[model samples]
Target: MNSRTPRPPHGSSRAGPPPRPGRRTFGAVCAAVGALVLAAPGCGVLSPGSNGQTSDDITVTSTMIREGEAIPARFTCKGEGVSPPLRWSGLPDETESLAIIVDDPESVGGAAVHWVLYGLDPENPELPEGTVPQNGKQGQNSKEQAAYDPPCPSGDTAHEFRFTVYALKADIALPDGAPLDQALGAVASNTLARGRLIATGGR
Candidate 1:
């Protein structure tokens, strides 16, 4: 026998195989995959609404009408019309220019276009309550007028007028009185972002 002495054998305690290098590598790969999975979309890794928020999420208010304010009937008729005041926030910081379009979506044939205005200052947070200057350039509305046409919905049903504000990367090239389709097309090609507000009136 050699000089060294072996210890007493334990019950079925044979030596296991040495740790495998491949297993360690596989574990590392699995860890990386897990990290990527946790960082993907809907994983709460990104900011909420970073892609963009819906019109409902924006804070759109009018000085004339409170958050739940009811619109007056006088503004709905042909006489003594005052454009409602509007205020907005939460616009994307990259906005370069602003456009405003107001339309009656309840029109019988498709959504009707009411007011189309591009090239407003995006820096300005509000449109002073009232009709924009008549002399100001008018985009082609459904009636072919370039001004705010108050809703004169028939029957007792309330009609919603949607005011959409587009944030553009550059000023639209069309002249004052451009057609609705053309203006919208220009916006589609150049818009950096947009916002909207809605108010309802019935007669």
Candidate 2:
């Protein structure tokens, strides 16, 4: 599990110009961002605030589990399989929308997505336990269903499950029950900043 990032060192300067827009599709853009290639110089980091300062990172926290720790059965397939309560803070002031994804990257075939959620308003950054945002759209995960899929790793090997939140410069347009890759692409193209929370789960 990673610790909170310390604030960017002091010494304010003029905020840079808005990042140059890219002409690529959302999927390619997302792959670049995910790889930290950033497409091009001006297309990477988002614009800072009027004060030439970036807002705090959008962090995700949960009362359900701690970083790198085992998740209780009540939140997994062996139990109720409910989505955990999540709260976010330090959102960039200019954030227009947000996206959330929960997945396991160590699955046998590849990254196994457990949840694909999007369209959360920046105004409110909390998702209550066992619920989804009213206006948000749910995407289909590896299970081919548009809902929360509990972490159910095979055997006794503990698995790491990540809950990531992406702050976007604008609201993303997505159809209901979109596929995982499509959801990620929309998120990557407009991502301003991203935060994450991780936990472990095992049968």
Candidate 3:
């Protein structure tokens, strides 16, 4: 006098529920970030790069490349060999000038300075792509030339390049085409704040 339900299924082929729409895969997240980077491609302080310690207010960025990303060949010897668009922000009010250094620490001899620029207008925080320094003067690089020596890594893998900006109390007084060491020393002495962006390049 009791009623019971019977089951007909064994090892059913029915599918589980679809993945949650709210969840994001690693590749999806990276693609989204890369798209954001591509959308912004000129010299303006859009966002911060890989300089992790946020305690420092100053930041440097390049619209051409993101942190740990490949620098465009147009900015390297393989292409047009011009400087990429760069910008910065978070300078203190006392800042009278700014400086920039692009170098490769993984050089054959030692740290190879690629490009050096100082005496930038602190109030202005943009260096347009392929543009030469206006108020600031360019300095010598590892190649012993006072110009942007684009990255030319010989190996299969790309080399890390650093683009550092220094907020200075006053303009660096070194003569144009001054030695890299002297220019670097001047920046270090007068720097009030600093930030950097690391990029990659290869032949």
TM-score of each: 0.62, 0.71, 0.69
Give model 1's TM-score versus the native structure: 0.62
lDDT of each: 0.51, 0.64, 0.62
Among all candidates shown, the one with the greatest TM-score: 2
Q: Could you arrange the candidates by lDDT from highest to lowest?
A: 2, 3, 1
> In angstroms, how far off is 143's CA in candidate 1?
0.9
The CA lDDT at 76 in model 2 is 84
lDDT by residue for model 1 (5-79), tens: 433312111121232231112122224223111112322111123234313233567666643234565555554
Q: Candidate 2 overall Cα lDDT vs. reference?
A: 0.64
Q: Count clashing residue pairs in model 1.
A: 0
**True-vs-predicted CA distance for residue 29, candidate 1, Å:** 55
lDDT of 1: 0.51
lDDT of 3 by residue, 32-82 (tens): 233211012221111233223212477888888899887777888789877
Clashing pairs in 2: none
Instruction: Tell how far residue 130 is off in model 2, in angstroms.
Output: 1.1
Q: What is the C-alpha RMSD of each candidate to the true structure, in Å?
A: 30.0, 13.1, 24.4
